[model samples]
Target: MKLPLAARVQEAGAALAAEASRFSGYGWMRGTSGNLSIVLDRDPLVLAVTASGLDKSELTDRDVVLIDADGEALDSDDPRPPSAEAGLHAHIAARTGAGAVFHVHAFDAVVAGHRWPGGVEIRDMEMLKGIGHRANDETVTIPVIANDQDMRVEAARFDEVYVAATAEVPEVPALIVANHGMYAWGADVAAARRHLEITEWLLRFAVATR
Candidate 1:
């Protein structure tokens, strides 16, 4: 008998919580500013994601909430809200066909976004290989969306700007929110982590080269 999707979501939550904590240890999540998720299913749209306002260092499996594609809580764990940015996570996952998404309020993303209103261009860097950046343009461009208090508005804005293509903007594994942070995604948690690391690295690399 196959495990129920809910059960699998729960399992994924447990695993993701550990990974999120590790990210916290890297000083990334810093006081609940970051969130992580694992997609249970894409069609029915179930996800195991961190809860809102919880300290990432102390996050447990219970801190991970199951939500639908719309970011509505589904696991019925005393109605505690999902991450405030869950909608953005869902939007990225849906748009990119990612199985996992990770968001972090890292320093490089914030600095880079503040410097570039249009987008951040990472050119001629070896680190680009980590996130699968391959293009004739010889550079990786990560879009930046201005942060908004109303996450719904921000999510909608994200929907408008974040289209990936080879000849156009190109498919970056990540995008930054101005003065907010970056969201990185991939086919799984490990891959998403790699994307996050590479994206953050590219920002720092850009700064270092300057």
Candidate 2:
């Protein structure tokens, strides 16, 4: 009893748009600096992603573009051009099987990353449970990668660190790019929202307490 692809995409697009609007309320994405995406189908690989340069607060499903695995727009000949970081979304989906990927340039994330260029470690925080930390005093280290203007190059650099982390910690819900921003993904849109919210929460907490 699965819904048709178009209907599903429409539903996902609406959800993504709503989430984007909510996140845009945050000062970080207030100027259209964040991007969000939700997967529609995996076989042919379709994604409903935010179109580039549009104000997230003003976006609805209309601004979501359906793109393939290769980041080709499937919906419109001029699909408003998907976000510049669409490639990162595609890569995260491929590696994590995540249904949604959310990226934001929060001041807290930048501050935390700058404060700890190697990465940020949040330990003994109750909020860490949001990202699935079990132990009360568990330490969670978010690996940070250097940034590149060419996102494809950035994606490759991310893969190297992401791949290497598999040996020690495999279920990485979010990653930070040095002075860039944070990317969070999860099984679906709701989970992605949870991860994104708490990751930003954790960053803000880290910056505040330090």
Candidate 3:
């Protein structure tokens, strides 16, 4: 079926919603603890982001809000706020050219965060290939920064991590925040979904083995 651009966007939003539900089932986004976003357009800058405090499993098109690069609300008569971590998502999108960003608080990521103040190293795992990076015998050190409540501070920390990380693995798709959650992005919504799922799987495996 030839869906209009709006319909296509809605479809993508629905896909993101479904992904959120799956994450919830896995206990990744428990008790309204996570957010999801997809780029509707990039040139003029429009992102379809999840509204704050909504149960992800019950998400609908109306639950999504359109925002600009500055994170200003662009569409929707509803005065609903975007997720609290919207700034972090915006920062990643602006810096990485990612078409979508997904954040969730999975047990592995949170537990690993509590242990690794610097970061966690996942080396030689075949799953690394799923994150659009080469999986080799070499160690893939995924840096984990201490979690912060201030979004601005959190965003700045991410900026530092981005610069340092690009110096090593310039194309890694996801990052971890200690005791917080994970941030994964990709070239488009589907690609972003792949990155999120792959990173989550890797973390789950790492935790299980450790």
Local distance difference test values of all predictions, in order: 0.82, 0.81, 0.78
Candidate 2 per-residue lDDT over residues 93-185, each given as its tens digit: 877788999998878888888898887888887878887775465678877888877767877877776733254454658988888889999
> What's the distance in Å from true for residue 2, model 3?
12
Model 1, 134: alpha-carbon shift in Å?
Answer: 3.7
Ranked candidates, highest lDDT first: 1, 2, 3
List candidate 3 stretches off by more than 4 Å: 1-9, 163-168
- Candidate 2's displacement at residue 33, Å, is 1.3
TM-scores of the candidates are 0.90, 0.91, 0.87
| Cα lDDT of model 3 by residue, 1-210, tens digit | 666767866876687788788888888888778998887776877787888898887777667777777677775676888777877787788878888899998788777767666777788888888875668866766667767777788878887766423545656678899878888898887788788888878877887888
Per-residue lDDT of 57-80 in model 1, one digit per residue for the tens?
A: 887767778778888888674578
> RMSD of each candidate?
2.1, 2.1, 2.7
On a 0 to 100 scale, what is the lDDT of residue 168 in model 3?
52
Number of the top lDDT candidate: 1
Give the candidate order by descending TM-score.
Answer: 2, 1, 3
- Clash statistics: count for each candidate: 0, 0, 1
